[model samples]
Target chain A: MTSLLNALPGAVSQGLIWGIMAIGVYITFRVLDIADLTVDGSLATGGATCIMLIRAGLNPWVALLIAFAVGMIAGFVTGILHTKCGIPAILAGILTQLSLYSINLRIMESKANQPVSVDKYPLLVSSRHVGGFTLKNPIFLMIIIAIVLITVLYWFFGTEKGCSIRATGANSNMARAQGINTNSNKILGLMLSNGLVAVSGALLAQYQGSADVNMGRGAIVIGLAAVIIGEVIFGKIFKQFWLTLLAVVIGAVIYYVVLQLVLMMGLNTNDLKMLTAVIVAIFLAIPFWKNKIAGKRLGKKEASKDA
Target chain B: MLELINVNKTFNVGTANEKKALDNLSLTLNDEDFVTVIGGNGAGKSTMLNAIAGTFRIDSGSIILDGMNITSLPEHKRAAFLGRVFQDPQMGTAPSMMIEENMALAARRGQRRGLSWGISEAERTQYYELLKSFDLGLEDRMTTKVGILSGGQRQALTLLMATIKKPKFLLLDEHTAALDPKTAAKVLALSEEIVTREKLTTLMITHNMKDAIRYGNRLVMMDEGRIVLDISGEAKKKLTVAELLAKFSEASGHDETSDKMLLS
Candidate 1:
């Protein structure tokens, strides 16, 4: 109990960082209505690019920005494959993810793992300051970043072009009939989403003091878990856009806290992936099951009325 | 003004299911001309409207609108001058969007969308008044999602959306077919009011012969992917459903066997 209590802050800070990536996933999965698989690759690409640029003696913030741009480029390729080449969106994301594996390895100079020592380089956030009350505390910085991101996104989505994007996702036929260029809006959405994921990746690499090629494996599942958890817990109360985003971050913190409890319960580290998949599958099925049950109940009532 | 010259469209080409949907069809509409099109199933009625709306690339054709060649224009590009309402009420509006937001989208149709606020206070007030005019009690539910509305309400809203921007041309593909008899009559009346008030150039397709003979300045009958009968001026004004059926049979050179056409 003492050790778990001590590890709580670490889990919270890590959760906040992952929450940023979850928000990026939310953009595609909820807003754009696309199950994009690019995050699994783009997350690694962000970390690799940031670590390499910092090692090459660039400013850490500048490196993060460049990482975001690279992520956008990857999203752009997926968008082109889906829209211009007429490939299905899921296939397009898979193809980009497959190609990104080699690209990520190349970016790390053919190494599977690379480290950016906190002792040698300045970083936006570090696990070394996990429980600190100082300005270097990642939890505080991440909270600030999350709030700013939510505010910016809220304002953007209220704009005309942003509304057009929403309309496209809601109904592309109506969007086109109302003169919206749905293809362009879709591309723009993918780029924005991946850019945020990259920003989260850059922060994660800095926090961990390393970037590994396989660091982002199954990242999409984690992001989906965060989004689904958030909605299940907070969807009823948080009708406003910004509040909904905040709930997603809160869900990530809760997920990490639960995972820590599971580890303390003596679950094998090798089984964590299977556990995550199982939990996510259960969460995803809740809504479907509820709907089905309600439908059956309604049918029974109607049958009784007819009788 | 609109013109379609030698428009042709074939679906499922080079396959066992090959079907020629539109066959060398041509049409012309002058300023403020409301033309109601009637035809049996697979008579190229809807296909003609789709061609004019740029729903798909015609196999080979030229479409001219307001003195501009728009044959190659994409659907979104052509939407600048066209307002369309489909047979299904769900097809014309974004169901998840708020009623006011949907109106705002239609209000800015063909205009450059930017970083500006989506719905202005002034626009909201104007939309409220306009919606109130329908007397459907929709003005108070500006923020309600269109998904929750009834089919009749949606069709009425769609009619308003089609004319919200004063489109150069309006296309109605059985816009009220899904509604109940009373609601359909209400929507048809509303359609006639809007068309007359705006003097809009329109091409409306209908399964109802009486509706085709009642509304619009001109009437066109299609069969076998071709315009078999066209009546206008005095000839169209004095025409009844019986005369239309008789003329259809004579002009089409075949007996009227489809009861769906006569009954509708």
Candidate 2:
């Protein structure tokens, strides 16, 4: 019990990093109404770019910025494939992802996993705190990540460009009707979505102490699960745009906590995939369940009135 | 002002299912000219609006809006001068967005969209007053998602969105056809109110024989991709639904499938 409690803080920190990725997935899949599969590769792209640049003697912050830029370009290619070439969005994302898989391997140059020397140059270097706790603790790192993500995204979506993107999601036709240049919005949305996913990937790679080929597997699903869970739990409380993103962050943390609890209950790692599918299914059904229940009540009332 | 000179649009050209949606269609709308279009199914009433709105490129034609040759302009570019309310309530406005957000989008027509908040208090107030003209109580529900509204309310909101910026021309493709009779009447009245108050050069397509006769300053009856009957000025003011039907019969020299697809 003590070990579990001790682990909670670290797990939550990790969850926050993943939560940012979840928000990105939510934007594309839910807000933009796009089934973007480009996340998997773009994520590794972010991590690999950061790792490679850092190894080339670049400052950590500069490397992170470069990672974001690289992610944006990757997303932009996917956008062009879908909008200009008239490819289906899902297929466009798939094409970008497949192409990126090769690009990612090339970026790594040598092998899949490249763990930095813990003694020589570990990224996000650890330090001792006033409380004698290592500042490298996952909780502190996640707190910083969550704050940065929530604040930047909150401001970004509030801008005129944000409105354009939102309008694009609401109705592509209307966006065009109002001269909103939906093509740019779609590209921008994918860029923003993938950029955040890449940032999360970079952080995760560093936190886990290495970047692997399959690190981003099922990432899209987890992100989706976090978004759906957050939206459902927060409901109207997060109806405001800024609060909505915050809810997504919280939902991601909760999702990880739930996973931890499942593990604590003695569930096998084999069942994790099943658990994810079931969790996503339950959350997605919330709206449908409410509508069905509401219908039943209305029907019963009508029947009683008739009697 | 909007002008279409010999607009020709053929769907699936050079094939068995090939059909001319717009055939050598020519139309001119003067400033503030409210034109009503009526025809049986496949009369190209909606097609004419789509062509003008640049929904599809015509095979051959020139479309001039406000003195600019917009025939080659894309749909979004042409949308700056034209506002269109679709036959389906779901088409014009995003169902998931708030009423004010949709109006804000419309208000940004012809302007460069930048990085900024979706809607400001000032924009919301402007939208609220604009929507008040609809009399659908939507002005009070500015933050409500349009999906929650009834079909009539959504259509009314859509009309408001289309005209929020006082567009140069407004296209109404049976905007109220999906609503109940009472709601449809309410929306129709709101439509007339906005068109008159804004003095927008508007084109409306209606399936209802009576609605065609009642609204708009000019009435155009389309048959076989052609404007068979054109009524306007004081003469259109005195016309009735029966007279309008007779004119359709006289122009096409064919039986009116009027009963099969006519609304109301």
DockQ for each candidate? 0.86, 0.75
Instruction: Write candidate 2's Cα lDDT for B1-264 as tens digits.
Output: 788898888899789999888878888899999999988888899999888887788899798877888889888887887788999888888887778777888888888877667678988777777667556777788889888988888888888878888888899999888999999998899889889988989999988877887888999988778787888999999997767766677788876555334523
Candidate 2 Cα outliers beyond 4 Å, as residue runs: A125-132, A285-307, B13-17, B257-264
Q: Which ten residues in a row have the lowest lDDT in candidate 1 chain B?
A: B255-264
What is the C-alpha lDDT profile of model 1 across B25-73, one tens digit per residue? 8889998999999987888888898888888999998999888999999
The CAPRI quality class of candidate 2 comes to medium
Model 1 per-residue lDDT tens digits across residues A199-296:
88888999999998998899999999999899999999997878888989898888899899999999998999999999999999998999999999
How does each model score on lDDT? Answer: 0.90, 0.82
The regions of model 1 sitting more than 4 angstroms off are B259-263
In angstroms, give how far residue A54 of model 1 lies from its true place. Answer: 1.3
lDDT of 2 at A244: 82
True contacts kept of each: 0.82, 0.84
lDDT score for candidate 2 against the true structure: 0.82
| Leading candidate by lDDT | 1
